[model samples]
Every structure is written in structure tokens, then in C-alpha cells.
Target: MANLQLKAIKKSYDNVNVIHGIDLEIKDGEFVVFVGPSGCGKSTLLRMIAGLEEITQGHLLVDGVDMTHQPATERGIAMVFQSYALYPNMTVRGNLSYPLEVSKRPKAEIKQRVELTAQKLHLNELLDRMPRALSGGQRQRVAIGRAIIREPRIFLFDEPLSNLDAELRLEMRIEIAKLHESLGNTMIYVTHDQLEAMTLADRMVVLRQGVIEQVGAPLALYHNPDNMFVAGFIGSPRINFMAADVVATTVGQVQLRIEELAIDSLIMTVQQRLNEGEKVWLGVRPEHFVSADGADCHFSSTLTFAEHLGHTNYLYVDYDQEKTLVIEQRELEKHTNGDSVTFGINAQQSLLFAQSGERIR
Candidate 1:
């Protein structure tokens, strides 16, 4: 296991700076995930840690040793890429033993290591089969097994599950979690999928445009995002954003009124000062809206469509002239499209952000 520390890590192509100065500490035996959209530089950062990319100006320390200039093999890291990278002509056994053989390990040791890795990944029975004969899940397992055979200090996975189907991805997620528990090695995973990032990471690093947005546990980031981008990016079905204006301000609370979608004024607790008539953004998650039955509706809209996902219901409502609100319901009554529906949200459940797109917590 290895604890990694990156100090002012940066990357640039010619005069174009992609990764700005980034500082992060990854603890030993911990599973950390780097999550962001494409062009956000998550993969580039991962490659830099693996010693595959040069650090423009920073230090890379693994297990208290500086390895910024070390070669990929000398950095004690094993990476499993999006593509399986398996030799189609070679059997699983051959693929597993190749790295060990190349490193000049004894024949007996290589054999033992290959069998042990296969057993750990549940690929023992498929050892004699080529990768072409294996399913996507099986091929991914083989890729993982190849990484495990090295027993590297840290495991780097560059969107390792992106190639599999939804069901296989879920299965492989469980397998990877179990594998981490069994090995207790430091692992770094890179992916744009927020669901995978939420489920697999002990701590997640949310990146945007090659810079760190927020770093915390999955639930922590979900419940308490530091900025507007983090709150909107982490949640599913997307969070609803409404333009709001400050109507009044008290000692501990501020009264707000919707700007675009005209609505009743609501008071929310605020530690930050809000000037009267100042514009701010109001964010409410889909799950926060409750069914409005014979009561005042804070949000009134026309039902555009409804989607049922087994236990949960998603209701898309068109509000005002252009705003669309998605309401999440648990036990929703049947309603046709174009039917009028009203939903309400508690003031405390909503978030306030400044015009600059920063949370006003």
C-alpha cells in the first residue's frame, strides 16, 4: 500500500495549460476517485500519477518517496485502461504470466502468481480461453487480474468499467469493491460517471476544467456542496435552478421571491447577507418537492411528462415561459400529460446561490 501526495501538480502542452496547480493527498489503503466530465483532465491527472505523463511543475510522492521523475514501472503502480489491452492470441494464463515473466521472475513463481491472481478474480476456469472467447465482464476481470498479478503499491483504473453493459458494470463494481477490501491497496479510479464515483469512492475529488471543485465523501458532497457547480453536478435527475430576488432580510433569515417563474415569497435561513432586491439562484432537488393537495403550492406548473422507474416517479413540469422543473414523487397519483400539477418545497430544503454561481451558505 502507498500514500500519495501531489504538490502543485501541473501539466501543459506548448503554451496551453491543461492542469493548473493541484494539490491532493491520497492515504494508504484508500480508494479515491477522480470524477468530472470529459475535457476536465481527470484522466490526464491519473496518467501523471502513474508516471506516464510528465509533471510540468510539481512533486509526486508515493509512500514518502519522491517519484516525480521515475519511470512508470519504477513507480509501483498498475493501471487497467478502458480497453482490456489483452493479447487476443494469448490465453488468459499467458496474459497473466507475461508481466511476471518480463520482470524475470522464476517460472515456478510466475505459475503460482498466475493461478493465485486468476483465483482471486474468479477467472481460474477461463485461464485456457482467449480474451475473444470471453464476455465483456470476463475480459474486464482478466484486465483487473493482470493488474493484481503485479501486486503494485497502488492500483490505477482509468474508467475500467465503462466498456461493460449496465448489468455487468454493476456486477463489476461489486467485484472491484470486494477486491479492494481483500487487498487493502491504495486505488485511484478515474471516471466521468457520477453514479460510479458515488458508489465506489471513500472520498471523491470533483474536478472541473482541470481544477479541483470539491473533495469529500460521496454523501457529504451530495448533502453539502460547497459551490453551485458541485451541487448541480453531483445529484441525479439534476437539481432545479430558479432565479430569485431578495425581498427582505432578517437577523438569521432572508425572504426571497422567484424572478422568472412568479411565485409566493418564502423565507430561508441565511448566514450571508442579502441586499434587498438582489438576485440569487434557488436550487431544489427533485426529491424535495412534496405533493400539494388542497394546499398552497409554492411551485405551479403544467405536467409535460411522467416517467416511472419502479419505486420512484419523475414528473417533468413546464413552468412559466421557459423553465422546466422535474418533480420526484414516491407514491404519485396517475395524471395525464398537460394536466396541471402543483408541488411544494420547504424553505429549508432549498439552497441559495449568488449571481456569480457560488453557494451562499
Candidate 2:
């Protein structure tokens, strides 16, 4: 079993602290992804798990054993770095065989393990090829094979596909996902790319300034965000926000006056009670808008720009106080610049957030 438990994890540099007390749990054979903006300490936390970074304070328990200050080699963990760290002078077989041979495994055992790993990664044909002769994808596979050959209980990936082009990244994503399925080892991957986090993770840990903002399955965090930062950060086009006020209240609903909308008061159904004239922020996704004639809240805007992405269109419009609004269009007529058009948003789909950025469900 490879279950990991982090107790009040903390890290610092020269007395300047980062990685605020972080507590997390990882079950055996689970795939967890750590994602956040740059400098958020996802990589630092992963390194701590690998025993590469010293923990300032906290207990790192793996399978109920404290391995916090253990040396990396004895931690039963293998890491795949952003750069494919292959030995330039070594062939693929040499790289995969080195780890087992160093552990004093029998020669026959090393050869068997190397051949099996090569077959699993489809690198058998290139086993004799040097790193210099391999493409970006091939080199990365060899790197992963090197880690797999050790049969470690845990795998750590730190932005492993960031250097590859978009197409290569997609291909590698599939390859890594397949590898995880075949291995069933505890895997912790870190990346700033939301798409990667969304697609690859069984659970996602969203962090900010070294503190975890939220953790859950990708869609759970997407549809039911705990705060504004998560709602804005999780989506591709990003969610929209407008300053609003509670004008009145009724049974199971509240009337809101959004400054950006010309409409008087739009009814929003909610489970929480609001004081009359209380200020709040309302948000909706880009694709939540409808034609003005069909919507309760309508707002006119000058079309600043539009993009046609073959199957869909992205509309950027200039709205109140120099704020820009993005509307996603699919199965709708194409729009162009300078067009004065009105759009509508559904009250039920709208999200309310307190001034402090907490979600008000």
C-alpha cells in the first residue's frame, strides 16, 4: 500500500516562508494532480514528497511510516522531470538497466525487467538508440521507462509535458494516462496547465501562494467552486463577473440589480437569504448567454472583436466602465465588430460571491 498523509506541512527559505501549513491525504493507487499559477509551491510540495526538499515542519507518512527526512533514494519514489534527463552517452536500454543494476539485482533479472519495460512503452525497437537519436516523445518515454524499471511504490511528475508542443503534449498525456492504468501506483503530478490537470487527475489540488484553495474531482470544483479564484481559474475562457446588489427578496428567490445590465431587477433563485440593498458579485460562464429577446437581463454592448474557431465563435464586447465581456457562440449566427447587440444571462446559472471572494450558495 502506498497511501500518503501530510500533516501540517510547512517550508521556508532564509526565514522567508512559503508553503503555508498544508495538510492533504492521498490514498493508495490514486492519481492526484497539483495545479496552480506560477510560484504557488506545487513543485515544492511534490519535491518534499520525493525527499528532495527538506520539510521545515510536518510529518510525511507513507503507508503509515514517517519518511519525512529520509533520503530520496530510500523513499520508494521515482521522479520524471520537466526535461527528459537522459544520459547523453547512454542508449535507452542502458538508461533503463542502470537503476536495477545499481541495486545489485541479478544480471538476468535486470535484462528481463529492461525488456518488459521497453515493451510496455513500445520502446523495444529503439532500445539500442541513443538519446540524441530519439524524438521529443521518444526521449520522454525512455525517461518514464527508467522510472518504471525501478518498480517504485510512488511516481512523481513535475510539469513533465511542458516542453513539448501542443500535439506532442496531447500524445504524451494519453501515454502517461495509460502508463498509470497499467502500473496502478500512487502518482502525483504537478502542472500549471488546467487542461492537463482536468484530464489527468483523479483528484485536483488547487493551490495559491502555497496554500490549498480547494481539492476535489475536476468537475466538482468546476461546477461548484468554493471561491471566486477557483471559478475564474478553472475554466478555459474564464467565468464573467458583474457587480450586483440585492434589491428585494421573495420566497426562495431574490431580486438583483446588476450595474452592467439595463434591466431593473433580475430574479435569481437561491437557498440563502439576502438583505435588501446588500452588495454582491454575480458571475456566469462565457457560454451562458442567450439572445437579449429571450433573456430577462439584457445588456447592450459594442462588438470589440470576434473569433471564429471553425466550430464555435468567441465574441468580445466592450461593456460598462471599459470592462470587456466574452460571449461564446455556437449554433448562432456569426457576429462582427461595431455591432450594437444585446445579450442575456440566466439567473439560475448565475453564481453569487461575497466581496471577500467566498461563494454564496
Task: State the lDDT of candidate 2 residue by residue for 101-202, as single tens digits.
Answer: 889999999999999999999999999999999999999999999999999999999999998999999999999999989889999999988889999999
Please write out the lDDT profile of model 1 over residues 1-361, one tens digit for every residue.
Answer: 9999999999999999999999999999999999988899999999999988999999999988999999999999999999999998999999999999999999999999998998999998999998989999999999999999999999999999998999999999999999999999999999878888999999999999989999999999888888889999998988998888889998888888885556746788999788998999888999988766532336667899999888888999986576688889898567689988878868777888999998898
Question: Local error of candidate 2 at 310, Å?
Answer: 0.6
Candidate 1 local Cα displacement, residue 336, angstroms: 1.0
Q: Output the lDDT of residue 76, model 1.
A: 94
Cα misplacement distance, residue 48 of candidate 2 (Å): 0.5
Structure candidate 2, residue pairs in collision: none
Cα deviation of 302, candidate 1, in Å: 0.5
Pairs clashing within candidate 1: none
